[model samples]
Target: MSPSLTCTSLSFAWPDGTAVFDGLDAAFGPGRTGLVGVNGSGKSTLLKLIAGELAPADGAVRVAGEIGYLPQNVTLDTALRVDEALGVAARRAALHAIEAGNAAEEHFETLGDDWDVEERALAALGELGLGHLGLDRSVGEVSGGESVLLRLAALLLVRPDVLLLDEPTNNLDLYARRRLYSAVAAWPGVLVVVSHDRELLDLVDQIADLRAGEITWYGGNYSAYEEAVAVEQEAAGRMVRVAEADFRKQKRELADAQVKLARRKRYGQKMWDSKREPKIVMGARKRAAQESAGKHRIMHEEKLAEARERLDEAVEAVRDDDEIRVDLPYTAVPPGRGVLTLRDLELAYGARVQGTLELHGPERVALVGRNGAGKSTLLRTIAGELTPVAGEAAAHVPLRFLPQRLDVLDGELTVAENVARFAPGAANNRIRARLARFLFRGARADQRAATLSGGERFRAALAALMLAEPAPQLLLLDEPTNNLDMASVRQLTTALESYEGALVVAGHDLPFLSSLGITRWLLMEGRELRETTPEALGKPV
Candidate 1:
């Protein structure tokens, strides 16, 4: 039978009493599912609940078979050997002992019928592109990306019927990510992954969008999900327009009815004052007119209320994902103006960047390389945060560097305050106004940076850097899309679209880099910088 996972009446709240999910029910069966949501929509929390890492406040999770889970941040003991991490050292030892003619009863018992356990373990590691890592090698010998792959390799060796992975490609390089993608595509059981990686999401059989503590299932892959959402939004917009028209018509009719009633009252009073009829007959007529006016007013009021309710329902159907809108004329550079120059730069870490490089005007550059190929180091050197060990790295114009950690913003300060610190000479009101364009309007601008979600923090940091004094004609971003949701990644792209400055961004996300209209592509390898195209980089290294 195919594996299955089900959750019923699931509810959870954080220790601080912030409710994330309430009475949420979802089910998955025999397919690869991609769980997606905004930054603080509790994607990770839901995965944890399914994996039994955290108990739900109410309801239960049911699984048809064994499960394996890989979290966003994986920690492995540095001293652990590869075989030990894969949970096969003891079994392998027992098999070896039995083969060596020391057939102790305990050794035979341990070996059981699985004498090929070592081979299976090796095969799992090889599938994950870690074949070179021997069974005896320590975890410390591997890089961060390799470590993540190693953990995944361990999970694969278990051969569970259900697999759960959370942001599995966050630290993986392009090659490593491709390996993970292959594994995900070949899985034969129920698999659910929560990730912002577009390529990874494209491999899913379906999308489970978690928004407002509810799951909305979309058939097919990420592209299909996007298309479906766009169509829904279009329909919703049409409904809103129709509702608005109806509301206006109702208001107009109500106003006209009131005016008519007022005119009738005036006419009746004039007749009564003139004594045009008998006293009793005039009194009866006046009472009838007053009752009719009251009824007309009540009917119009009811119609208006119904129109408003329809308008509210239509508006609710529309999504409210805000985009960053800003005019950065000060950041604009004139044609042929030099922004940065690097001449045979050598980083402090012994990485050599050969030859001279120059960026002029509003050129956009994409820096691509393996994990330790000095892309971040080169960006830091250009930003003047690090001095090159040999040749010179200089920026002719004002530049700002946004590191992967996003440590540019002060945690204790409000978003507006952080912007103010960077643009010291700008007036407070002006700073707040600029922040509103970045989607932090009024009260939102006053939110402390420490309390912001991943996406919000990124926006705040970008605002601070772009709105800084002297207007940063050159911008340097290191792995800017790392740890960001797809929505946040799109937001970053929108913000960059408004920036008229020279940009150098180091990232492994090819799609995002392509969206930025990168004018130049530089590959960092062998401690040297070589110009390459996106197509060339996609080929075997």
Candidate 2:
């Protein structure tokens, strides 16, 4: 089958002269394709080009049919009604005019053959778990997750031939994500999604890996792609080992040849001193020896150069993914000390705590809830960023909160400077040393926070929070993995492993929460909290 989308010799560069793609070619056929890459690799830019939201500086983006795009961030005007947001307000108005016996040719034309447009719109909304939403309801009344579903519903209503979704699951809760997965599974036309959600990637027919302005296709889903990459990396590592051994052998041979030449030169000098033969014969012997030595030296040098080239090629084949190394023993909490306590707490949003509760030691707690369930409000209240309506939410030790928006970082400040603000007493050298563990080595720590990518910003924010002067005996994180790539997520997991503080993380990412070694699971539902098991939480509400 022919590809639904194709790019030929595509080239694009930002106004700042940073080139994103050059002489790049790619094709996406009629199937679901998951486009994945590390942060700053331009996955979203490629999607935009395909959707006509962006134009390439050179070459073209060819599409077989109509396109629908859902961007990473979906913003709706507060005044927009549900029907207006779905692009059916005019048709609905025309239908109402006809029903009231005031039909005009223009109204009929506006209605066209979509007499059931309203019903179809409602059905589409229902399919996306928005059945409870009224067509006349204001957009401001819906939650963030609902807005994402509403945008997707609009796209589905259009039924475009090629669908593009960039981080579609960014604000979606578990139930919303399941609805999206079903829609993706049922999609029959070309679908290309730029996302870091592993579960969403698992439903795709193939994986498109974008790196260094090039694309490489792998059959099957994310797991299969990972397996293939692992095998390839293993082979590359073996090749590197072989090349290094060959390089060492070549160097040893070169050194041995040099030593032999030096010994011969010394022996020739001794023979000349002893006057063992005629001067002409001795001189001829010396000249021949010098010529032979030159040849040997040139041959050995050539071999060594070739070996070095082989080693470089072999090394290039291996992938380089840096990991964060964090050590914060000072953040550890004593086993018997109370880290947090909640007594008859009533959140600002009216979510109530059933009874008194206490957390001690370095307990890791997972807070799971549906969207609009006040998870964020509860976390904010616990962090002292919000006030409870009726009761007390107290933290007995120094703590830090990493919210989903990552607003803890000051955009105008350098990464190291931001960390220093949080760690007032820490010396510059000490702050720089800790920042290095977060992968901001040397000059990288001096980069402005606004210039950092999503992943880099996350690391910088985490470093600031963890390396604070008070040592954060309790850490509260709200959906920390929302937009992070898989590599960044793994790095976060690694960094959290070294943290000895009490943790209460509110997130819908089950795999990530599980990896944090959570000892307790709390479910927020109907304005109350209940302790539960991971297995129980895995089930649908």
Candidate 3:
């Protein structure tokens, strides 16, 4: 098979010369590959480099043929209809033959024997649950998630030899994600997927852990990589501990030798003062002392080399663990069993349809539906951001809403500033410490909120909520895992699980909600949040 994308000593750095990853080298072959890393550890940036969307500071990203890249942020221009934009890619390719003169055989080959690109595009769109949108439906009428799906459908119809996807499953629900993975897995091309979905990662042939400008290859899928990483980490720790122990022993031995040498010299001096320095062999005795010192020096040199070797391994074994710690401080318990009550709740904006919503008690409910579904609106109504047009929405305690879009955070202030702004009465030092707990310590704590990623923004907003004098008794989250990687998602999940405050979340990711052990599900459709399942919540295809 022809070689796919190749990166020879790929090096890239920011404008300030801060290295993202340097001396990086990897080749993506014709099989599925997963790129794993923490947030800001160069996963997405590397994807961009591979797709030729971002030029590296040094080194090259070479690809075999035409590449189709689907970015995490899916954008569709309003000028073009969904079908028009998608078909345009394949259409333009076919048009190339008509514009230029070529041999008949080659020309026929360039434009596939049977001209059915439109049909192919429509079929792909159907697979992605976008068939309902007609050939002339405007992209501006589409939801964000629908736009993302359209982009993928377009990419599939283009049939590029190289496929690069960054977080394709981010906003997709369980059914949608399954559909996407199935479609991608069937593609006959080089697939390089950068994602945090464990189920998705299991489909890849190899896993590349990008950290500190290096990619360590691990055969098999993410599960296998996890096993190997565990073993390697244990071995590294052992080597480091052994080196430290040996160094300590060597230091003790060196001290003992020095003391012995010093004592021997003093004894020799005493003998000389007593006029008994080897009796008639004084010159020989002095020579013997000099030889003994030379042996001691050689021993020290040997010990020095041993110490250097140990130090080298110790340094090399150092590894980094990127952990996100969110310490949520719960407010005093409300004098009520059920915190939020929604009964036949109906919400909508103007002509948008919202079905009836019914929720009750302190149960941790997962509000799930499609992108344009009334999930966010339901959360806003619960948080008093929007009043229901009909039906009742009531809560026993103060409810804090963390919107999926994260408009709750002020983009102008630093993380610390935002936290303090939200919880003004928290002790200054306590606020700073809280910021540090959320992985925004030092300059990160002082960073402008505008520069934060989707993950950091959520963390900052959560940190502020956690520090509230009386933490909102009920925490309402709307798609909390949108931009977070797998590890970060786990971190957030762990933090939320530990929270005593009740949680009412509206999320699209089944893997995440399932992982969190969410039992209750309120599926949304139109303007209604109804009890539903994976199959019944499907968007019209």
Candidate 4:
């Protein structure tokens, strides 16, 4: 009834606080507000702050109604059953019994005619395309997509007035994703979703660009935001160019005048002989004095001052353009045929087969698959991490593997030690420099491998991979963008695309993979690996 939520001058940070939001202000009434930003800009933190579970260092957030938050990673208390987790028939009686205190008592009374938790859960699950799931199944045993769907269903069951979702579609299949979008589109409550999925943004009415400790409102969807931002960026660029040009012109004039003065000074005494007469000396002095202090001279001084002001404004207005580094190197490999190839390879887990796998790599190939499809097991077989049940995985080229988790690095050793151990013969300085490029600079490079965030750890693993004399001919990546923010993902993508060798990576970020133009794909169904197109395997994350 009242405004759904209100936030004013809200600012927050940790004790050793990274000042995330500073004097932030916004309001959420009854519409979709899409939150967009590069990774680590504090989108998640802001959501938590608004939910009141997290306190802000400054300002306030007041909510008038109940809210539901769905984080990207849904931690299903693995011990809970599907029916238990879904609040199926088993939980409805309790939900209704608790409804004695609710404002929507009439609606509950109408619906409470039956303890139809299964039917209700089914209806919600159907909306997320997850109705087919067995009610008795364990939530722990469910697939990533299913768990995600269950969470969505749970959120809907409560029917909160405000929904805050982080990567809401992380566990959805294509159809499920579409359904989620449809639900969001039809919903009357306030919705705030933080996601990189462009398709999802289409349903949102506005975008809140969260960056540098503030939220900037942009009307309409992602496209409109892009267009408007483009114009703003162009304007900034124009200002910079104008300022630089004026500055350069003034500087050039100043240099020219100084040169002229120098030339006259050098020639004045000689050309106009003072010894010839007092008149000649007086003439030279008069010429020099007039040139030194006229309006033109004053104008040059004014121009210099104006130029500096323009330069400062230009610097202040420009925003950094997004750039990523793949750090591709041309480490020669034995020029040969396929190092690893999948020919009509099929993948399935216990006969619930998905798609086919069709891919080959001669260099450092990354074997990628979704959560259950056994990306890790595939990598293991190739690197002897696991034994493949059916398909023959042949590694024709010499290679090293970096798992999603850097199990290779011992926890006790510092990064330098890990580097030295694996990359034996490399100097400490070289290791430090390589680590620095990935943001592990200075003393930070000495941090134990256990201390790194998911992204930082991955970078360190990459650094370790490159430390060898002959870099691996193939690289295998699994959900490389999982923990890295969009910006870091962009950089990693850039480096991987330009990488001289071969690759196999499994990821939900289809837009990103397509941009890199992956050569092949191995679609994972249940346990089977079958040949497929890059287009078919991606989940449109």
User: Largest TM-score belongs to which candidate?
Assistant: 1
TM-score of 4: 0.76
C-alpha lDDT (0 to 100) for residue 14 of candidate 4: 76
Clashing pairs in model 1, backbone N/Cα/C closer than 3 A? none
* TM-score for each model: 0.96, 0.94, 0.84, 0.76
Give one digit per residue, the lDDT tens place, for model 4 in 47-116. Answer: 8887766898879988878888888778888888776786654455555555566545554664465556
Candidate 2: which pairs clash? none
Give the RMSD in angstroms, all C-alphas superposed, for model 3.
4.8
CA lDDT, every prediction?
0.92, 0.92, 0.76, 0.69
Q: Could you give the candidate ranking by TM-score, starting with the highest? A: 1, 2, 3, 4
CA shift of 512, model 3, Å: 1.6
Candidate 1 structure quality by residue, lDDT tens digits, 301-415: 9999999999999999898787888999999999799888889888978787778888899999999887787888888888878888899998999999999899998999999
RMSD each, Å: 1.7, 2.1, 4.8, 6.0
Query: Residue by residue across 1-541, what tens digits does model 2's lDDT show?
Result: 4439889999999999999999899988899999998888999999888777888999998888888999999999989999999999999999999999986999999999999998999999999889999799999999999999999999999998899999999888878888898999999899999877888899999999898899999999998999999999999999999999999999999999999999999999999999999999999999999999999999999999999999999998887667888899999998899999999999987788878989999999999888988899999999888989988998999999999989999999999999999999999999999899999999999999999999999999999999998899999999998889888998899999999999999988777798899999999888798898988866654
What residue pairs clash in candidate 3, if any at all?
A: 21-213, 353-526, 353-527, 354-526, 354-527, 354-528, 355-527, 355-528
Candidate 3 lDDT over residue span 1-541, tens digit each = 5549999988888888878877788888888889888778888898898887889878888888889999988877988876677865445455456557634565556566546766776788889888888667898887777787888988887789899899998777666776887887787888888887887888888998887778888999988998998899898888888888888787888888888888888887787788865566866786799798779967976896798698677768666555656545455443346676676566767212344333334456788766766678878888898987777778877678887778877889888888887778788798887777667778888888899876777778887776665677788998788788766786787767656666788876666777766657777665455576544544423
